[model samples]
Target chain A: MRRPQFSALRERLLRAGVAPRAVRRTIAELEDHFDDVRRELEAGGLDPKDARSQAYARMGSEEAIVASTLARPELMSWARRWPAVAFALLPAPAFAASFVGSIAVIACLGHLAHSWLGVGLGRSPGLQLFSRCFALWILWALPTAAAAVCTYAAWRRRISLLWPAVGIVLVGVLGSLTNFGVQWGTATSRTAISAGIGISTGHLLPPLVRAASTVGLALLIYAGCWLASRRAEEAGSEG
Target chain B: MGDAKALLMSGVPELLILRLLAEREMYGYELARAVRAVTREAISLGEGVLYPALHSLELSGLLRARRRQVGGRTRVYYNVTAKGRRRLEYLTSHWRRIATAVEAALAGPQHA
Candidate 1:
């Protein structure tokens, strides 16, 4: 396959952790510089091929350009670096906390409602399982909704898709891990796995189901949100 | 240039850029050519140094950039800020100090 022109230069700058905006600007400037040189050369009567080669020679080696550019860290300003990293990281904790907190609060409210109706959860295990599963779905759906809104806003602004996508995935991973931890803790304690009052592993399955379903639902929501936002952006741009 | 001269050149570009932009807004190509002309070819900052230096100066709030079409071509023009003027003042004085010291050293009695 034909290689992308300037791929090496792009990779070098990006690998050195240059801001994407700066790299893009640099690329645009390089193109202009080349054009200017080529124009000058062409005016002197050289053909396009010779003019192009001579233009490229005037810019010096790619290595030298990348080195000098990156040598001054301000060219990749911390203003750009920290904000992008922070924005990508912000949603992870928010999503995880929302998922876990939503589940916990919903579970508590469900328990209270059952107790008030004179039918405690443990007395009706099937109802308890259903309520918990519903709670898990809500836990997954709420953050997914919030993420969708964020994705849509970012899409409208033409911000990069990579960071938000990364944030959503990270949020999902973190939420899943927290959900697993809660499930394991609740199962171990409620099952009386210690104090010589062990219960069957089969009985500890509800929380496991809750954990898996919540993560699965979250991933689905994220994927759906990303797709919808991307479609909307494309349609808006085309229109 | 020797290592000593290279070291001095390191900080000189930013000064020259800020000084020139303080006078009037100019684009990358114009600035490069102007720098060469004004320095009588004693200093030649290639695109490599010119652009990154511009970006750095802009990031530092010493310069601001805008895009405008000139002769049917879009060009990014840079202008010095109030802060840039202050920076130029400081750098100019600093350069004068060093140049004066270097000049005195060169004119000192021959050790031989």
Candidate 2:
């Protein structure tokens, strides 16, 4: 229909927060359906130009499609429906979950290694190995992951970054409060793993200090990404 | 009057789509053809109404869509889910009741 302006339709649907997959499928199907309809019309003895015009008419107006899609609540994303939850409220929780989940994985791996490889994780070399991984996760991976998730959620939803920025800071501060320690156990205990929450309780600096630094690092990374994207967009427009 | 017609027409595309897919899995073009055939072109839904309704149904867990290669073309086929079947049954009964009531009304006091 009028060449469908399928790209424009795609942009409109995405701008209106229809899921990308649905939008892509819809546009593709519409293009294909138009071709079929035009072919059928031509077969029915209409002129090629008439068939083209009629095919467009049979596809319905673009506004109608957009409106109908908008009316379906389920087609809109969760982030679109609740920007606050997806961008703001979920970051700290997501950080907490990442920290806990990573710790669990490390612990599980230790257990599996001990069981399968006859290595006592409580001993020197084995304990040292898992503990290094644990420290890396707590200090670097978990915090970075949380910040990345928050940034990505905002970017993907095409929502404002104000809440996600707040979310990143909150996650950083809250994530720093947890103290995780792994050490060789006493005679009765195996490899001892401990978790507690307090201000600067672990090997890290004070709570406020670590939070500020972590947030600073995360923001730096995010800023670099934003700058790169902006430059790319500018370059694209220029070309 | 336009609003009323639109309101009445709501759920109609979903019902027809679900009912058709409930019988056989079909891609978008094939399904549209089937709808035209079954309704004798009386209820021809253009891409606007049809695709949106299909997507809504899929998102609501009422329909399942799959992609398959057919004669070198990748066609997406849709089938009604268990949830869609229940939804179809409900819509069918509801439509029949409305049709009966409208018929009775159209037939006037004697029929009532």
TM-score of chain B of each: 0.90, 0.92
Give the top-scoring candidate (TM-score).
2
In model 1, pairs of residues that clash are none
Shift in Å, residue A65, candidate 2: 1.5
Report residue A215 deviation for candidate 1 (angstroms): 9.0
Candidate 2 residues A1-239, lDDT tens each? 32334656665777688776677678888887877888999999999999988987888877888988889887787776677787778988877877788778766765565556553446668567768777867966677678777776565445567887888888887877877877654344544567766763465666666677667766776676667645645554453
After superposition, the stretches of candidate 2 with alpha carbons farther than 4 Å from their true spots are A1-7, A17-57, A114-134, A177-189, A194-239, B39-44, B59-61, B82-90, B100-112
Q: What is the interface RMSD of candidate 2, in Å?
A: 1.4
Find the candidate with the highest lDDT and give its number: 2
- lDDT tens digits by residue: candidate 1, B32-90: 76787889978855655578788888989999999999889889999999999999999
How high a TM-score does candidate 2 get? 0.73
Overall local distance difference test of candidate 2: 0.76
lDDT of 1: 0.65
Docking class of predicted structure 2: medium
What docking grade does candidate 1 earn? acceptable
> For residue A113, what is the lDDT in candidate 2?
58
